[model samples]
Target: MTSAALSVNIWSIPTTTAGTTRFTSKNGHTLDYRIHSGIVGNRWVKDQEAYIVRVGESIYKISWTEPTGTDVSLIVNLGDKLFHGTIFFPRWIMNNPEKTICFQNDHIPLMNSYRDAGPAYPTEVIDEFATITFIRDCGADNDEVINCPASELPADFPANL
Candidate 1:
């Protein structure tokens, strides 16, 4: 029988905030911190890998692997160094579909979201109404934004379906 690994305490609820979810490590290091609640979509999952709550911003592209048990790991690539952790998927990621977790490109600026894959970070800046319809009806038809490939998605990320 396979033994279940202990869940990493990579999350916390800040005393100062009412319902904000703070993603942190056991050692107190933060990855991606955000004030928004609810699950984020899979299209954005690759960007959120191995993140923590730092100050009020959600730091992404950090890197880390599952410390123990199985092959689980969360890796984020920060330009200089990588930040990572051994933990379970955020509740929102598990409960919601990729479409539901989708957000407008404008939200990226307000939250300080980023990625280190390329010089230009793929972002959706269209209005929320257009963004939703874009994801629902058409996929990445814009030249400005490059949608993430379904094949490169992590095991836990919402499926192409």
Candidate 2:
């Protein structure tokens, strides 16, 4: 599923910014406002933890930067069923996480995407690709370009994915 060959002109699209993401290591270390997160193989992982989180079963890093940045990195090993991701409960999400959501339309630029998370913000889910509907997972190999839409990705942008 990993392919660097882009299928779309991602630059034609604008860039959008999300909220601050929180990353916690296995040893109980917390880093807020992650600024960046990416996969090792498909994209360049600036955060060293990204490499560690991708491999080791004992460690997992869950990032929710969708408020401060455009990407949301989530690593989950269901077998461990560790108190991570959803229930990790960082400081910001403690009050009302539901209120957290990102927008993508004509004005704001939608740059990066993530691996897999929740649905994007939309009033009513549309079937057309006329608008830039951010992906549930967004990324790009180039550091300058936030989310590349991976080129081969469909324009529909995973309403049900």
Candidate 3:
């Protein structure tokens, strides 16, 4: 008889001692995450361009903004997921959660962005904050903000968040 094939996904790799740490779900299933990145990178170049994603949470998303600009981005692994404010994570969330770096933010909100089935979809109204607060400029004077090591990394986010 053939043993059950081991299931694998994006997070399957870089799973060596780096982030192979696993957690047991209430149902006895094994869960793990890939939390990477630690540095104070660059601020956004465009208004409201900053992004954030969390894993293993019900809400999945929590946002805060200001007119002065956040001026930072980062990526980190909590338990079985990775969080970041970079442009890459959002695209990953769009294609396949399983293929995400660590499959951490697998339970993001599923919203219907469209209303009348046109080329575009209706937008959601977020909190009252300046677009520049999250991201201020988008010109050559601003940094590219894609340097993995040089990216916007916070000092320490609230634990158990």
Candidate 4:
């Protein structure tokens, strides 16, 4: 059987703000990212592959795969740079209807909310978020945002740098 052709979209998240960004496609579906918690992770997974991890009190299945005609030379060049670990992308055989999947590459920003109060002392805060690249299997018709705790990252998650 012939494999389905794939397409991709690339963009950047400018700041560590709390909001949602939406991308509309001609196929009548929308791709969106809702930044509820700015905490992000620096993990990398191969194209079309996924990994299950626990963040905080929640568990999420995160995956990533490269698309055709995309230039991954930068990522390849840094392959041997000694990362935390390697995450292999898995092959999938689907018998369902064909559709376009959206892939996003961005640093997931994380925030530190737990801080101690002191006399005339400012609360401890982390102004930065971890960079987490993601791939969405479904398009705009889905509105589910999987939530995971910021401290629940894998011990040896591959670095995307």
What total of clashing residue pairs does each candidate reach?
A: 17, 20, 15, 15
RMSD of each: 18.1, 15.2, 19.0, 19.4
After the best TM-score superposition of candidate 2, give how far the Cα of residue 134 lies from its true spot, in angstroms. 23
Order of the predicted models by lDDT, top scorer first:
1, 2, 3, 4
lDDT of 4 by residue, 1-161 (tens): 11111122222222343212211111222223222222223222112222223222222212232321111111111112111212221112011101112122321111011111111122122232223233323432333332222234345521331
Q: Judging by lDDT, tell me the better candidate of 2 and 3.
A: 2
Candidate achieving higher TM-score, 3 or 4 = 4
Please give the CA lDDT of all the candidate structures.
0.27, 0.27, 0.23, 0.22
Worst 10 residues of 2 by lDDT: 122-131
Backbone clashes counted, model 3: 15
Candidate 2 per-residue C-alpha lDDT over 107-142 given as tens digits, one digit per residue, 9 for 90 to 100: 123212221232333212111111233322223233
Cα-based lDDT at residue 27, candidate 3: 13
RMSD of 2: 15.2
Displacement of residue 12 (Cα, Å) in model 4 is: 9.4
lDDT of 3 by residue, 46-118 (tens): 2222233333331123233322221223233333344333222222223332322322222122111211122
Output the better candidate (2/3) by TM-score: 2
- Residues 76-155 of candidate 1: C-alpha lDDT, one tens digit per residue: 22222233433333333233224223332334442232212112222211111000011111121122122343234456
